[model samples]
Target: MLMQIEALLEHIEFLLIAGIVLVLAILALEHKDLVYAVFFFGIMASFVAGFFLLLEAPFVAGMQIAVYTGGISVLIIFGVLLLPIFHDTTRERFETIRKKRLGIVLSIFVIILSGSLVFLFTWPTEIPAVNVDLAQSLEGLAQWLWGNHGIYVQFIAIIILTSLIGSLAILKLEKAEHLNPESGVYGLATWDDDTSEKAKAGNKSEDTVPVIMAQDAEEEGT
Candidate 1:
């Protein structure tokens, strides 16, 4: 009876987590705000980590939380926030509405298809017999990841860095184009208000100095 109760409770917990993850996935895909969408995605990832925990894979769960929820989600949020055009309100509302709707529909369809596939397919029920050493496995995994695939990891990092730089450069060019339609470039040499004011002050001082000198000479002659 106690074992049955524990099994029942686990099923309930699984259902609750599954429901939350599904809702979060829909919200992440359908939300109009990019930041809110990313937040939902992060929460969904956390729940996925919970699923990994339920499967008795604590290492995978921890990595999921650390890599997806902590690192990737934060990077995506920062990238969205740092974008120069993030606050641009002049975009046409109708331009991407169709695309967004299509994406939502496609996502829903895909989810349904995947569910059907999972239900139809016969998954392996038997556990494979293997003598596994946890510490040795982990050590081998670490060595393979860092020693064998270190260059690939570095390449991915470089790609991410280049993408960020390229995004910034593209946004800057767009801003410059908006500022100067004819030249398609922003001129740094253009006089700003401060520069113009300084020039005016210098001219006024030069004129006033001559006038003061003339006034002083007139007084001396008198």
Candidate 2:
């Protein structure tokens, strides 16, 4: 009876995880707004991590949730916020004809490749015995990460940290440019009283008509 209950629990967990993954995938693919798309992407990454956890890969799952869903998603949101023009309006940029054609071709290729791979792979009819020792798998993953792959782990950490710093720096530069026109960070000239006067002078030159004041006097003499 206990074994049957445990099996049922495992089956339910699997179904729930699969459902979450499907929902996340749908949201990620269908969302139009970049902000909403990033949000759904984060959710999708979290669901993927959950699936990995259910498969007894705790370390990889934790890293997925932490690095991808948390760190990267936050970075993306911050970058979006840093853009001065982001708040002005919400409109989809129309894709060029060439871009549309390329996208369609790439999508068709992916569909065909995936279909062929699925059709080629044979499913085993025999059900393999499930490993009930979840703790053992988690321990093994921890050992592998800290022992054999510690250097690799450190390298990845450093990469993520550097990327975060670079993104922040770019955001700072954009914000500075937005706030100060005189800074000339993006080839933007300062708009002051002198600049306004220069513009008026230029306009006056175009609008002004030169007059020959003596031309009428000479015609009268003739």
Candidate 3:
């Protein structure tokens, strides 16, 4: 009875996780706007990272959430927000034929690759003992990261920081250019009250001269 209950719980958990992943993927694909798509993709990546955690791959899961969901997704969202596409008033253009074809091909490739990888790896899987030495595993991972993989981790961090700063700089420049009169992007020429009054006075003087000239012409004709 206990074993059966455990099996049922596992099944339920799997189904719940699968449903979350599927929904997130669908949301990502169905959204027409880039910003919404990035949001859904981030959600999907986070859920996938959670799945990895359930599978006992804590390091891989952490990396997934950090790099794909946190770093890449944030960058994509920032780019989308910084661009003018978010303000578009027209309907979004559908994917081109070339893009559709490429997407289909990629989907097929992913399916095939996933199948092949599963087949290759699952058949030789010696069922290792379930005795997970949590402390030892964590220590080894930390050592590996700080010893050999440290430089790579630092490089990734630097790249993400650079991207963030570059986006901020671009946004700042765009705003400054819009506000600067000399830039002439969005600045409007504001006329002073004195200039307006002078223009109105000049118009009145021209009107009086025209009227006098007309009267003089009429009197000469009579």
Candidate 4:
């Protein structure tokens, strides 16, 4: 009787966690606001970590929390915050809106498909227990990452470095474009006040040069 009660409680806990994770996933994908989407994603990652813990994989759960919830989510949030300053435009906004709608549709489709699969499939009644030693697991993971799987780490580092270089290049180009008013993107030049004033002065100077040359010619003829 006690074992049945414990099993029932575990099932309930799993149900709650699964439900919350699904909800969070939908919110993360379908939300209009990028920051809110990232926030939901982080929460979903945390819930996934909890689900891993419930499966008796504590080290995997901790790694999920540390890698996804703590690192990648924070990085995405920062990117969402900072990217708009450089890329804020009507076209970009429209694209974002379109993508949000697409995301909503995809999320709905995925949920329906997943539910259908779950309904159609027969899940095993008995799940095998996992006995994990944290220290041994960590050591093995570290060895895998740094030894035979070292190429994967190198690839990831290269990708990150390439992205960083690309970002720096974009910033440099944007700065150069901002300095040159003619190169401003989509008629939106930063430092508009100063650039406009300089442009007006240049126009005035060019106009006066023609007038001054004509006056000099007329005086010489007279």
Output the number of the TM-score-best candidate.
Answer: 2
Prediction 2 TM-score vs. true: 0.61
Give candidate 3's whole-model lDDT. Answer: 0.73
Could you arrange the candidates by lDDT from highest to lowest? Answer: 4, 1, 3, 2
Give the alpha carbon lDDT tens digit for every residue of 27-121 in model 1.
98778777888899999999999887676556778899999999999999998788765342222233345676897799899989999998999
Instruction: For model 2, give the 10-residue run with minimal summed lDDT.
Output: 204-213
Question: What tens digits encode model 4's per-residue C-alpha lDDT throughout 150-172?
Answer: 99988999998999999999999
Candidate 1 local lDDT, residue 222 = 60
Error of model 4, residue 201, in angstroms: 23
Q: Report the C-alpha displacement of residue 50, candidate 2, in angstroms.
A: 2.6
Better of 3 and 4 by lDDT: 4
lDDT tens per residue, model 2, 147-215: 778998899899979988998999898787778744232333344556455544654322232222244
> What TM-score does candidate 4 get on C-alpha atoms?
0.60
The lDDT for every candidate, in the order shown, is 0.75, 0.70, 0.73, 0.76
TM-score of each: 0.56, 0.61, 0.56, 0.60
Residue 54 of candidate 3: its Cα lDDT? 63
What stretches of model 3 exceed 4 Å from their correct place? Answer: 1-4, 85-106, 113-127, 148-151, 154-222
